[model samples]
Target: MSSKSSSQFSTFKDCLARRLISTTDLDGPEGSDDPLDEFTSYLASEVWPALPDTLYTASYESLSSDTVLQEMASDPFYISLDAIPIPTSFFDTLTSYTHFEDAHDCIRFLRKVLSDYLTEATAPPPVWKQTRGEKCEICERGWVRLTYHHLIPRSVHGKVLKRKWHTESMLNSVAWLCRPCHSAVHHVASNEDLARYFYTVDLLLERDDIQAWKKYASKQK
Candidate 1:
């Protein structure tokens, strides 16, 4: 990486570290320092090097053309049901635990319930819509055609797999965004960046360019 890019990355890493410390309660008996240390280490060892040049330079045609979308859809990286480890009998196990054996069993049951609740709570919201006239999720503009944007871009599924940060099920998630918002995303960030960081409508909307685009798109036909 160039010196400028490296410097920018360091600044970004520091900013992220501060934000994580302030905004998230990663503290435990092990202490808050460990989480901050681990996060900074992860950014240095894993995230910074994986960023792609295309994120800064990709054109709308490269990002939005039907050809590109079709290629991504046809890529063989899709996570099949067989690859997932959930046993077919897992739900049966849940059903069988009708009575608690002791305090430990009660704690286990409550833990499971809490785990399931958190999973359901943090899992990305569904973005697919059957109709075309609904307001755009990104800009909240009404009466516009919204397109389905793969949260983790299909084009970068291979990179995502290589990084081991996400699974096939996560890659298949999508968001409904307006044309300008969608275009601005690809314009500002590469497929790899999308897979790693900006993989949600909320994250994409945080970008300065996307925020500007949303303001502009909200005023258009």
Candidate 2:
């Protein structure tokens, strides 16, 4: 029993850590950088153990009932479910609670805090400046048909595992394109190919050459 307890605690910590590091800003000024570390550390040491049985029950209930989550499900960029790790059982339990408003509040807190935790681990900051390209990255199609896409597909890199910070730097390259061009790009590219497409964007951005990007997209088209 003691061994099982220890293992569960360890799993929680790892989950907590992964959640934190994925979203927090590690590069900001002292206060601006991931602000939740202290709270999370405290929770690890004291709070999580002390949390009432009911809150846990309510939490699981709230997650299950959240209709808004489906919007995320619809995204083409979304990946596997484990990235965020909200168990189906927990969601079911969350939906069954009577104090649902309170449960909703708690769930929100956990989601926000955990997301922040994850950001701190995997990303640099909370927001990023958009860099615009005049042509589609997939087709040499010009700005009129261009829109930005995640070179690595944000859904794959961490959509299942959403980090506020990843949203900032991960989309470093924006291929300007119209809707049809964007659809065509995805239709033709394999998952692996899409991953490479982002890598190419990173390479071009590193060199600060838009013309090179245009040439690459032209070839892709």
Candidate 3:
């Protein structure tokens, strides 16, 4: 890349960081301005750290971070929504040093990083340090049959996919709760509201109604 191109890339990085800090929410990043740049920047800065290893943490898996940064820095990348021709030379170079085994591996890891990053940034923290197998995650009631409540709800899944509110895998994420606690959660918010804003258990637990439900239902039945 020429000096001018390098400068332009740096400017894009700065602009994106500022946009992220000031913007209260991200809706439909697929349609966001400069998404290609934002994605590239995320890989370079966030994914490349190679820290937060999944070996010891159930949290986000940081792939070989340095390799990702080095790959992009050596030769830039831009993904196009429309089909575009690429030089054979670009592939030859990208293939030579890529840490991934193949194109499939590359895509899988990249997608995982992007999706997990969004969830971690906005979703509320975990309510418990550890979960009990038979207990309702909310009211901590054992002996009652626990039902898995889709935190985002299945009814709004179509909206979630269309709006890009969350990655598809996250739709299956659930919170274990007794039937009473599960019913109370739905009363706290509409399915759409939960899908967009309170898709995480911690976020649901933040609500006044949910907090009160824990107390009221702990002794019920």
The most accurate candidate by lDDT is 3
Candidates' TM-scores? Answer: 0.44, 0.26, 0.44
TM-score, cand. 1:
0.44
Query: lDDT score, residue 105, model 1?
Result: 47
Q: What is the per-residue lDDT of model 1 for residues 1-221, given as tens digits with 9 covering 90 to 100?
A: 76445544555455445544554453422445666666454533443343333222222223344443333234322212233333323323223333334444423432333233223322443434443347788779877777877879888898898987675556677777777777777888888888899887788878888888888877887
Q: Rate the local accuracy (lDDT) of all candidates.
A: 0.55, 0.43, 0.56
Error of 1 at 61 (Å): 35
Question: Candidate 1 lDDT (Cα, whole model)?
Answer: 0.55
lDDT of 3 by residue, 1-221 (tens): 44433443354345444443443232224566865454446534432233222211122222234444333333233222023333333233224434445544444443343343333332333443233367997898898998888887889999899998876657777888888888888888899998999987799888888888888888887
Worst 10 residues of 1 by lDDT: 53-62
Q: Which stretches of candidate 2 lie over 4 Å from their true place?
A: 1-129, 159-168, 171-173, 196-198, 201-221
- Please give, for residues 66-131, the per-residue lDDT of candidate 2 as tens digits: 433222223312322334444443434333322334445435535554443322332332332255
Of the candidates numbered 1 and 2, which has the greater TM-score value? 1
Report lDDT (Cα) of residue 87, candidate 1. Answer: 37
Superposed model 1: Cα runs more than 4 Å off:
1-133
RMSD of each: 16.0, 15.7, 16.2
